[model samples]
Target: MFKPSAEQIIKVMQGKGYSVYDTPAVDWNLNIVGIRANDPEPGTFNDTLAVFQRLQGAWNICYYQITTDPSLHYLTHPVNSSGTAILKEGQYKGAYQLDIHNRGLDSGHLALCQRLKPVTVYRDSNRDNKLNLLEGKTQTGMFNINIHRTCEDYIQRQRFSAGCQVFAEQRQFAEFIRACQASEKAFGNKFTYTLLHERDFQ
Candidate 1:
């Protein structure tokens, strides 16, 4: 498997020229992309790239833990008996909300919803009990594609996610929230999030 360093991920995000989350008094666009490595572990990836860019060419890159089960099959359906889509890989775009009411918790994290073409992984019980992945034309539109923090202090703790991109490190996720909040204050209340597979880069 090809493991990407922080610098490599930034290079890829920078090359894409997507909007960035920067400071105030400047044209800042919040672009957060989660790049999944080719790790075969379930509900976790060996490397995750979280990069935020500023319109003035400034950027911040943070390393976070994503599910190792980086497969479409496990993304929409429950992997094993976890009942979570620990790893969902694809390119997705939707409205980013800075303050959201999720699970009766209101935090600094963000939610990506509203006209979202998100991915879905569900088990086709009638088809011999097999897991299936659907998106785009075959998708029926999914909600709650949130980018939030997790309870895991380390990467190996088996953090749980229901197909959402979770950050195992609380500190890192806090910093991310701060950046997005700053961007929101300067810009509008909506942002853009994109999740790309390792193959999609380069």
Candidate 2:
């Protein structure tokens, strides 16, 4: 149940030489988000996925757990045991949009706006131990990979996330959504999301 902080993860990514696209002119205001799961314990329903953001040369990061399919055993897969394809690593272009009927609250309150863009995921091929720009390519036919929140308020039982990245804490998730919106307003509706290796944090 040990969760690593966003700073630690960012440090690890930097040590690994992954591109930190957080400058002002790289991609419009340099709004970038990073995520990667850490816990590998099977039957661990609420595993932690660290969230990090660099906007306008300032860092706002937090750690939150998430729920994948209840039947999966590995850290990540293209598709879980429930048939939901795991989001592959690489740079993805995304934005915020409201979803009234999304899976979260049973009362159907307005949850955080979900990410509204499909990511062009990059793969680390060649076993070179680096995420280079040349290794990135647009994934065709990969659909429904979103960054959203979970409905469950408590942390004692199994969760209900199909495949999307589901933040367990409501308040933190709301804050994240707000940051995404502000970034969108300032720099258009496109932001960058990078997923690092799960093993790096371990």
Candidate 3:
């Protein structure tokens, strides 16, 4: 019953005063931006109040980072900040949603606690309490999970939706983090966000 969508997480991040923004596919003036907590040791990498404030560097506002840490149990961001928001454009105005997996991590695993949506079920024609064969939806080949979701929760939701009694419990953050790190490295300069000003000419 406890399910959250990627959009909800974005909204939560913005409410915390972290500053969320979209890179703007082409016209950034109307793009939406959202800020998130920085990687494990951001303080050692930057000279800001990162320890006191868990956020990506102001200079890196355009970039979003999610990492895997062996010491953490559930995903955590800055408690001080309820969240943040930035003006931009996308699927909606004021708020929007995007699969966290596509947020960019380069891995198929995600942190244990972000947010997720429970799968929907279809009613069977038989009118029986049990799900019918055609009404069942199975996620067999699905693997990529590096997004805003907990693997255990995701699998359970999937199984519940598919009417299957099987579900995966427990997962390794390292494996998911490794994939994200690899993807992070591949991004290189792309990891950097750009601050562009709108031209009055437009």
Candidate 4:
């Protein structure tokens, strides 16, 4: 029910000094934005991942899914133990491109790869399993936080997202991948991702 219109999103983007590709020539202004909910709980899919685009002077919501925080599960039992990666909110231009996930494996699938560029992320080193985003070190590097799908069935836990923008459902992710593939064919492999907090909806 927290779905936002394209105009609302554009306004928020402009307010934050972020770019909005509204040119008619630009068929797909792909945007991957994360909406952090109020009273967010760790290890739960309380967040939203929205995929929208501007095509032919109109806006379209390609897909949206209930997604978990990038550093939710890792807060308690971090993969690094020293620091948990939490993606900073803002627009990242050309931070991702199309590529295969888990390549050369049986579970390989089409996904947005972030190997082409670097992104800013907060390294939450508390390891206390709490949602304190700003109380961490800010670092910018190529932290392969690719956008990919989770399990084929119901997702009971936040096991897939280890600082990556992940999808909760497989069918929706497939649809999103198709849209990305179409966008890739129309434009190119480059993609811009924007992460937004729920408060930005105002």
Predictions: Cα RMSD each = 6.0, 8.0, 19.0, 2.4
lDDT of 2 at 28: 29
TM-score of 4: 0.87
lDDT of 1 by residue, 1-202 (tens): 3445545655665666643344634744555666656434544545564654544554544455554232334334444453333334444444556655255654433543333344543322222222233332132245454676656432343334545566666676677777777767777666666565687555
Candidate with top lDDT is 4
CA lDDT, candidate 1, residue 46: 51
lDDT of 1 at 116: 34
Stretches of model 1 off by over 4 angstroms after superposition:
1-28, 55-60, 68-91, 105-138, 152-159
Question: Which candidate's TM-score is highest?
Answer: 4
Put down candidate 2 lDDT per residue, 1-202, tens digits, no spaces.
3356656766776786655545543322433444444543323444554545554556555555554322232223323332334446555545434444355646454433335666543332232212223333334344545566655432344333334555666887787667656655766665555555566666
lDDT by residue for model 3 (20-100), tens: 444333221222222222222211111010011112322211222222111111112211121111111112222211224
Model 2: how far is 194 from its true place, Å? 1.6
lDDT of each: 0.51, 0.48, 0.24, 0.74
Question: Cα deviation in Å at residue 31, candidate 4?
Answer: 2.7
Which pairs in model 2 have colliding backbones? Answer: none
